[model samples]
Target: MVLTLVRYIREKGMKPGDKLPSIRTFATELGVSQSQVRSGCLRAAAMGVLKIVPRSGCYLADVTLSGIIGPFTLLFEAMYMNVQPPLIDLYELKTTLERGIAKRVAVIRTIEDLAELKRLLDAMETATEHAEMVRLDELFHEKLASSTRNPLFFSLMQVIHSMLRQSRLSYKDFVSEFPQSRKDHRALYEALRDQDALKAGDIAEQHSNRRKLLLVKNY
Candidate 1:
């Protein structure tokens, strides 16, 4: 139904801000019930493909990357809920992706990117609250990914971060290893600053492995 509606919009040459057919009209034209049409419209609206205007009508919205990924966000949440993968598995996946991201960032990170990372690191260093530290930790990694100047890497990290949040895993869980983690982060940052891609990648892998070991020992 969503596909049909999107196709209909495209077939009609509808652009953003263009009004869509009424739900009843869509239902009749698509040979679906009004309820189904409404549901499809609502899904499209949520995906940013359309906008619901209350009593006014539905209109096309400016499509964006976030809008395109919105539906997948729900799917990701559902998968995590059902599968409940081990923390080690999540750590492994994060490590694999971040190793490459670190290398790329080391080669291409700009001055501004380094400054942002430095800020996040400084904040993390002083963060006494477990929750705050975890938040800062995630932001530090996100900023590192962004420094790679690859949108796809950043998006993938965002998805992984979402999964971590859903699993309720916190940096505090690895408190016994916090000191090493801090040192690893600092070293990784220096490696990037020096444009030492290989060193950065090694540090990223070691950092991930250490966290995985901690999780295993504790949980």
Candidate 2:
């Protein structure tokens, strides 16, 4: 009921400060009991999507970035509640977004961004075990996202990171067994630093594809 109402308002392109339909009118329009409409409205308020003022009408929430992400966070939580492995489709999507971003970063990254990438690479190099390597790898990508200077991209990457955290750490053992990633990172860092977009894109795609392949082969 709550989701239905929320979806309707969203479909209408309503924004914060917009007034919702009155309870009685909304109930009649939706052909629902007034109690049901009221319940839905109340739940929407709890979900941070609407606000009800005493003696006044409901209004859309002035949602913060976290508030916007809240519903999706809950959805992902429900998807992972059983500790099942994450879907490969998500990794595929992540790789696509990352490779595209890496291409752009390679072409347009600033000197400071390259320096940060190098620092992250060095940190990854020093990490001796799976756990440390996983942490460093995440930092490496965070630096990559920062190079793009898009906060929404950074936020999405964080969500993607959380989704794959376990698989990523587990896969680090396979990554650590080979020196490929180290060599790849060096080439990748140089390519980006030199603004060699094509080389950087190729390396980024190869790196991501290799990781995906390793996951498939081992687990």
Write one digit per residue (lDDT tens) for candidate 2, span 1-219.
776787788899998899999999998988899999999888778888889998999999898776766665555455667876454666676678778778889878987887788888877767777777767777787778777876656666777777777776666465555468778888888888888888888888888777777776666
CA lDDT, candidate 1, residue 118 = 91
Using lDDT as the measure, the top candidate is: 1
Q: Could you say which candidate leads in TM-score?
A: 2
Model 1 scores what on Cα lDDT? 0.80
Off by over 4 Å in 1: 1-45, 49-66, 82-85, 166-173
lDDT of 1 by residue, 18-56 (tens): 998888888888899999999988887877788999899
- What do the candidate models score in CA lDDT, each in turn? 0.80, 0.77
